[model samples]
Target: MAYDIKDVRTAMDPVDNQYHIVLIIILISLIIAAGISVLFTGGQGPGETLNLSGSLVEQDSTGQKEDPAETWIVRILWVDDQNRTYSFQDYPQDTKPDPKSYTFTGDPPPGAQAAMIRFLSWDGSTERTQGARYIMDPDSVTAVLNRYTLMARLSPLPTTTPVTTNTPAPSGTPIPGMLIPESGVVCRNADGSCTARFGYTSRHDHPVSLPVSDMNRFYPGEPDRGQPVVFMPGIHHDVFSVTYPGDATNLVWFLMDKQVSVGTVPRVNTSIMIEPISGYAPLEVRFSERSTGSVPNNPLAGTWNLGDGTITSITGPFYHRYEYPGRYTVSYTVSNACSQARDSGVVTVYQASYTWDTDPKNPATVRFSCTSTGDPSVWFWDFGDGYTSWEQNPVHTYQRAGTYQVGLTISGQHGKGSVVHTISVPS
Candidate 1:
């Protein structure tokens, strides 16, 4: 039933041909209009236009000229109603130097839910990033972002829009039904053999030694944006939060790649030695400082307060002679960038006198008595007969008469003393 062209044309006539031509022209016009609509509107379906604008600036010493250079990069993320995320990056033009603010145009896809935006500082070798999240409003078309441009060295970026539609902005009180880091086996290694090895610098640049391998070791598996967990070695970093509905985990991002300080606080031990703890006038004493606890060396850099009103900026085994009989306190203080500590000791100086007598009843027997003028805290006697005694008075009987050298040493709160005498005995 296929008809030849000539037969078909004869049956149509001029009136039919003109009608078909008009229909063809109308169809072509409709197709062209649809293409134009898609080109201008990005083929969006039933949603408002999204206008995202922000500014980035390089850091200067004077806090002026906060604008990004031409080579910087910006990345933006958009989440649709289906929870599908779309990413746009490689926007070098947005970082033109010394220009007006940078802006992005987006057609909020039908059923769009949330959005996130971040800027990157790139030097063709390394990149620093700053990001913030927001709850997409189907009714609003404008979103604004403002924050410090540098990472780790500056403040966090701030967004004007809300992160969620139902939740009000954080006020004075905790929000109702707000989810926090969950508590379902935050760490692995059930046997408790795992050890904490890593540490990070906090926002204030203070080093926090982690008690575990990392914050994620407590988690059952890998970490995500929405897990309620507390930092170990106790909460030392800036609190940063992230929630990816796609992953369903709240990941904390406080390990902000900061420089950690090395070394430890310094500790010192002060020691004093006096030849005679109790003696006459003009007693000589020695003071020494020994570093006990430090990584490599002591961090203290302050002076030594001799406690006798003599402050010297010297780390010493220092010597001093006391001219008068009295009690003196010695101390040393050391300080460095990390911390400071002080150690002290005491020295006493006094007069001492002692004498011994022998028993005439038995020349081989000797009874020694301390007639010391100073009240000695302690007394020692060397009989020179192969015997020693700590008592103030001692009696010794020699097996045979012989020549002997007897010595007595005494110490008290004031000072120290020593006396030696020669004795002869006959059998």
Candidate 2:
């Protein structure tokens, strides 16, 4: 029977009191069991609670208040066997006028084999990692999460002290210290691109600001490539990166009188140059490999994907002919012990041909249609008479009717080709 809400309520109300109590008890038992399952299985899965406590002491205590605009970030990181990194970070604020210590908690991801802590300082635009420390293990997994303490002394923020001097400082008076440009690591990206990191070390007691000029610049390209103008006093790594397609090499950063080359690490750099990228069918295209790597005299094992169901392990400065007409993507890859690089280009093959349709009533007039491929930029049409036209598709009238040979010639960046057909014109 179909029961309404009132009917269902009445049916439920007829249950005995003891049965109602038993149902309530069963529901409570099920809820308690679920809670216990979650507490054991869900809560305890794949992570650990980390209690991080640290103290920061100023290198030069000036008895002055800390800059409100400045922020310090404490990061705890660990890597698993799969080379995946897990990080826990906290931003500590100054409670007092002069900040001293900080305390916070973090949850590190599972399989954390080794743990390290890094302290960073961020002042609006720039953020720099001051230093990093690896925690010594008492045991394997359990030692990473327990109560840990770190003590670090931070460098004083840059300040300008006024000096009373009546006479102007002599011209070319040497600056107090020097700024050395240093090249950091080269990182390979998943998209086959690479990045070279650059940084600087400031030996001065205070911060230095240099504009993008001859004193501070990058070589082989633009003078300014998003490098920092303001430098903090310390050895800061990876201040900026130069991202380019393929491997980076011979990139130099010029700071004052010092210069450093980036991407000094040994790796293969690949480039493909294809001449006459597009042409008529049975097109013979030239492919050249301009790849360079650190290993000199090392034979580069290269592979080419002709994109026409043809794959060859041929070292190029070679030729490949496309028998049919279509657009095909060509790729070349070169590899050695250091690393591998790959580049791709497109080759378009066009078939030179045309179709002509004559007017039914006016048999002397004809419309010539150019069906040639590859978007030919230049077209020449000869109507078998003395008249010629440059239009892709042209119409012509014959004064006298006879068998005539019409020709069409097309040309583009790919190359040039021509085709001719004999047609009978009626009188």
Candidate 3:
């Protein structure tokens, strides 16, 4: 029988209260289950973001986006192998489908309506780039998004931090004063090949000469000869070392090979000095007075006594000046930079300038005093008594006296000097 609203109300009184309550509870539980299922199963399907890049094609021949077919709505209809359908809801980062990479974040609750995504295309940032596009699981959308965001943090803005890289400097120890040009290689073009010969400055400071092209060819690469390298000729040599002896410092320019570009002038830093130069190792001069019993006014020839560095004759400056009638001094200084040097000598003893006037009209032979610079000192003296002696200093009596001229000559490693005097005798 069809129950009217009045009858249903009447029947409700007969229904058990427990049964109705139970029914209510069961209904509520079913609803909750359904809700849970929907929440967990939900995924990206509708309202999901879409990214597309590249120029849109137009129905018209113009191929420009201005055409109606290239509009946003028209672009969303992507045709695939299956021809499935999907649409775009939002295009973030402004221009849709920009070449920029995209990432998804936190997914919707499970058991909810899912969003479907279809990748349209992507455009490259520049001519060098290859654009990309693809779809991924929306359930994992959140994690992917977080990953991209972390990466985007790295996507530098137009401005970026500058990077610093260190470059080592080109340096080496300067070559010490060159005593002579380093050994040089010279190539001899013989027949069809070349032979290299290494040569050095003279044993005793000499000049060198060679060609330039041959020098360049032989060095760095041992020439056809294979053993010798070539060198530029005419390089002034410096014997000085980069550092002094006993110096712990090792300072030298290490060339790939021995070859140095000596063509250009180089500054000198090493020092070389003449330690010592001896002209007259041991020298002596002697003057003797003739035993005429004539009684020579002055003592004859004084002993030179070169006396190792002690002899004032060449001790230094006054060397040439003093008792010069016997011997003189000579001094000099030499440097290594160049042959240029300084030297000086003066007549220390001016015997001729001295006065000698001893009287007794008659006398025998006479002598004078003087020392020479040569290994074997030679004494050439003019006695006031009209006579001369080889002895450094000699005393003599005038064989026959009248007016007499006296003089002495002395020579040494420092050069030579002489002195003379005038003597008068009367009966």
Candidate 4:
């Protein structure tokens, strides 16, 4: 043995030492066993067991391979039959599951109800599940409901790597839903599905047909005297006409929503009469409404002088007139102390008049002249000769004409008159 140190070292080689080989085989076996344990062991029944997860994930010093064990348990949400959900400690603790509830590991009691259960894991919302998705039977849900209990475990295990997700906001514009204050709403959704709507209307601060959220209220009866009136914000129509003594002042109009479409021409039926408008100011003319329950001040009522300065007395109730042609606009404004509304209509202006000015003997020339008075808005004249004019006075040469009873009319104003003139022409 004392011959050489080198010879002694060589004698200890693995080929000559059996214990080294044995130790190597044991190390290999231990490694294999650890691998098998990584697999989750399931329990009896259709239900499956899931590994515990952590709210946060730990990185391994060695970035080896994808390990099935990689995951974190953030929370446990268990839904029950009533669609209610319950969650216990994310990890097992001394505190017990509700005596009335069930545990994740145990079989549900008979007649128990439950919603979907989840063992969610995450590292700052980079999440994963403990097990594959599980859809319990409807009948089993009842069991979950009866037990209303869920369990979680806290423990760490060797894991592999995980992935990330895309985070974006929900789609579409979300309008705020709010409760209507005091009055609730003036008009709710035509069918009352959701909440009432609030908005602006060019025609009315509060439109009826368009529906509005009415927090406060006023007298609800037809706000505009039952005229199919709607308060919509935008250009719209609101018209009413009044006459003198005979013709009643009763015209009503409706405001509609066209959504920006070309609108139909609105026709108005108006009359004129000489009402002692300014009872005190005799010089100023006034047209009073003959409505049964007439209001003292109606913007639609007006009076005018029937042209030809000589006619002093406008002694009629009211005279009716058809649609006078022309391009004109009539404006009407309605007001209450609280709010105001206005509307207008287009009126086309038209004028025509026949003159019997020719002194029969003077064929080419006229001798007498005629004059008509009042605002086109005030009056119009119809020379019995099938001619009408909105002029104050007109002169003309009679080429050929016969007897004619001239007619005069006042438009929106309350006044109209007629006179006859005859002229003979040689044939």
lDDT of 4 by residue, 65-114 (tens): 33343343322334434533333223222222242243455333232332
After superposition, the stretches of candidate 3 with alpha carbons farther than 4 Å from their true spots are 1-265, 268-376, 384-386, 399-401, 412-415
Ranking by lDDT: 2, 1, 4, 3
Tell me the spans in candidate 4 whose CA falls farther than 4 Å from its real position. 10-19, 35-333, 336-422, 425-427
Model 2 global lDDT (CA atoms, 0 to 1): 0.65
Residue 141: error of model 3 in Å?
82
Q: Residue 165 deviation, candidate 2, in Å? A: 99
Measure candidate 1: CA RMSD. 21.3
lDDT of 2 by residue, 1-427 (tens): 6889997887777576769899999999999999998875546423332123322323324445444456655545444545332334333433221222332333344554335555666566555566655564534323322222111322222222222212111123124346777754565566766667776666532356777788777766777777778765445656678765554456677777577765544467889998888889888989887877644323468899989989988764888889998989999888863468899999988899999999998999999999987678999998888899999899999999999999999998668978899998998
- How many clashing pairs does model 1 include? 24
Which 10-residue span in candidate 3 carries the lowest summed lDDT?
Answer: 70-79
Model 4 gets an lDDT of 0.34
Q: In model 2, which runs have C-alpha deviations exceeding 4 angstroms?
A: 1-265, 294-298, 399-402, 412-415
CA-lDDT, candidates in order: 0.47, 0.65, 0.32, 0.34
Residue-level error in angstroms, candidate 2, position 424: 3.4
State which candidate has the highest lDDT. Answer: 2
Question: Each candidate's root-mean-square deviation in Å?
Answer: 21.3, 28.5, 32.4, 23.6
1 against 2, candidate with superior TM-score: 2
